[model samples]
Target: MSDARQYFDLPSPFAMKRGGSLQGARIAYETWGSLNAAQDNAVLILTGLSPSAHAASNAEDPSHGWWEGMLGPGKAIDTRRWFVICVNSLGSDKGSTCPASLDPATGETYRLNFPDLSLEDVANAAQALVKSLGIEQLACLIGCSMGGMSALGYMVLHPGGVRTHISVDTAPQAQPFAIAIRSLQREAIRLDPSWHGGQYGDQSYPDIGMSIARKLGVITYRSAMEWNGRFARIRLDPEQREEQPFGFEFQVESYLESHARRFVRTFDPNSYLYLSRASDWFDMAEYGNGNVMEGLQRIRVEQALVIGVSTDILFPLEQQEQIAEGLQAAGAKVEFVALDSPQGHDAFLVDIENYSRAIGGFLARI
Candidate 1:
């Protein structure tokens, strides 16, 4: 199949929210369905940290996407009705301008010298992409995990840009627990001898550090209830057990090992560091004079649907409640649904039936 990914060139000297800029930045995105002459039926999806622009497969790329089950011709995010677009986060390694991309000025990979990234920058880049497509206002804006925070930034930075929103498993800001976990993940990568202060090449990649960080992330992505139910003290067979003294033993350990191994090599470590730090640093409070709710109320939308899993320890249900309250205060009709899925923060991705009912029902009304 042909490549479906498209690129939008951001205006030169794109300023960063922090204290730097990029001269020749570009954003990667993909589209499904046709935009009507009015261009008012557009739906934009901002993804979590790791996902690319490929939110669903099309004729150009038939491979399944990360959200393959949720977005399709007749799925929850029906492409037949809404002109859907998914943009790769600006700082992602997935076909976007990131630390992995060569710096035009230096003729080398940005590595640690890349500008300090913020979700605001991501939001701005996405907005630029939307404008280039001739969309003045999106019919709906959908954000998941870190993408939710970015969506908040998008709404706040560009008022009246979105008519409605769907927030899934995200927070207005990084709570102390979430910050602490991300801190540890970053520390693991920085401490690895092979990291070499972000100068390591593929030959000397920080595999162990990346592996440990991914393991830690996976542990928090799902709930302890799901873990116990899935593994249930299951031990590996004698032949599968590691030969070393402190090797993998439990079935959960083996599962995490395989998951981490597959992830570490595919993702660029520098890009991960930038995006992880950006997620922690995002605070709606910054826009609200140290009040998160006040900042959220500044966004102007007609309606919203906030969904959260009860088992999500990373972004607990209370955060979703906060989002609903803030959006309601902003005069938007808000519906907050607290799901009982045991999959924790990952419930939105795993428990499709419940999510589809909520999302599809809401969209059907729209």
Candidate 2:
């Protein structure tokens, strides 16, 4: 765990909005391909909330990697062609600095003490990492969801850093519905008896809180159509799926339970809280005080592509259109496409053909 956390760029200055400056805030990341003699082969791909620095092949899980479908030799983000870099954002807990990491001041974990991180701060830290690699400009900046927000913020914040931007099912600001759902998920964690205000004692973990939080999150990450189609009131023999196992009569209950359990095992509760809060506080309008057009005008990228899914409840197709509209208004050559997929917001990750076609065409044009 310590070694994993060590793969970082620490003490990266960020004058936060919540108050005092964070001293040990770090960004965990990894790079793929090579930066050519001119360092112009650089392609920056920011990660969503859960993914890590392992974007392409590595010694472990070497059979391609995450985003493998889109990023390959002759594919869209071809690693055989361009240099790729992916980083774990500062507030992320997946081996990056977050509430789980120990605070240098007290030697105790930051836990709830980890300051609130905004999308702009994430973009700034990621920009610092990009600069460290000697990349003064990027061929492209592509991201999904929260990562998508960061990508747009990067384009807006730096103006001339990236030539092309690809945003997938993302928006400039988190919608109210998104915020409400995320806030409820965080509340689920806090309401747990064992949570103890983000501090579960050294003994027992906040199992109940974390489990509930994951369930809440899973409910939003997917679509109702998917749930109905997958579960369909069908039970596992005897007309009861969650029964004899201390019982759940509804198929939805069983499905949610399994997802919640899996998430509890794979994710840290504090990390969930931190990232959720960070997302809840996201707003593109804040950057421009009030004018979204002004915010959009700040970007200087040559071209842009925004992809959205029709059934996505988290970030609907309309939100994605708004992103494209914002870019087009900025005088950027923008294209908006709403991919037809029933998988909801996660369609960007699951529906490969449509995503690949859009991304490939867009990149090919560039």
Candidate 3:
């Protein structure tokens, strides 16, 4: 693992949040710029559900990550000024040790046998990586969607480690509405005949179920206004599917299919199950013994910024507002920015300029 600068092995026998420990546990991460002599210029970026450690173009990999529009030398979270590090989540299929990883004890993929995981585990793993890098304090920790939850978890878990926290399009806890959607996504994957209790082996996978789930996710990630504006009633040519109902004619169906196909090809089905469930299981209030403010109060960060998009129904402006209020109530300096955009929950990734402005300005102050 040391041979590959992209991967880091946590000093082995890493303990998980639920129980049990992983031997030879490894984390995949990408770094930009240089860590200063004091190691105080580090910025940790936690990704959403599907992004990899490749958060932007760098020397090793020129390809841009999902947040290409916002991260780079001169962009928001500028690598020119801060040593930015992005780590793939612990349970992610992208290069990280996940359900798809080999089980050293049995010489088989962990699959369903992978231990129960949670957002706390995700935060802890990233923290471990930071410590291993010899970073005593972070200039900032940034997250969006699931990453946002991880950022909050970092604050609660290690109160003084991060100097600032930036959360976008996320909440302290997964709302029931969001949980219901994710539960359905998991159900779709489990119901696929090929899943075979997550023991499909080398045979075909649950592509149908995984594809369906991704489609469902696309619907939630994008706003109805944006879909209508982009797709409208546009129909696939009648020659494409003569026997199909007119309802399937919308271009949106084609869009969903294309995106889902891309996702199902690379993502591991079991990893999806674990990570999605982990997101729902995260609840700061529970950590606070039923009071969110209590959990927020535990965070000792110098300041925080929360950004919300108006069209994000999955995690709406109200949720971000509450996060800011909780932080304020906890006596932590906080700033909440509500943005109006058509991208819904995905605005942070797609509508880059808005996020760049808010983030860049905030980082400047920090």
Q: Best TM-score goes to which candidate?
A: 1
| Candidates' RMSD to native | 1.3, 3.0, 1.9
- Locate the minimum summed-lDDT window of 10 residues in model 3: 1-10
For residues 172-277, what per-residue lDDT tens digits would candidate 1 score against the true structure?
9999999999999999999999999999898999999999999999999999999888999999998999999999899999999998999999999999999999
How many residue pairs collide in each prediction?
Answer: 0, 1, 0
- Candidate order by TM-score, decreasing, is 1, 3, 2
Q: Candidates' lDDT values, in order?
A: 0.93, 0.76, 0.87
Candidate 1 residue pairs in backbone clash: none
Which ranges of candidate 1 are over 4 A from the true structure? 1-3
Worst 10 residues of 1 by lDDT: 1-10
| TM-score on alpha carbons, each prediction | 0.98, 0.91, 0.96
Query: Which has the better TM-score: candidate 1, or candidate 2?
Result: 1
In model 2, which regions exceed 4 Å deviation?
1-6, 11-14, 60-64, 238-240, 243-246, 250-252
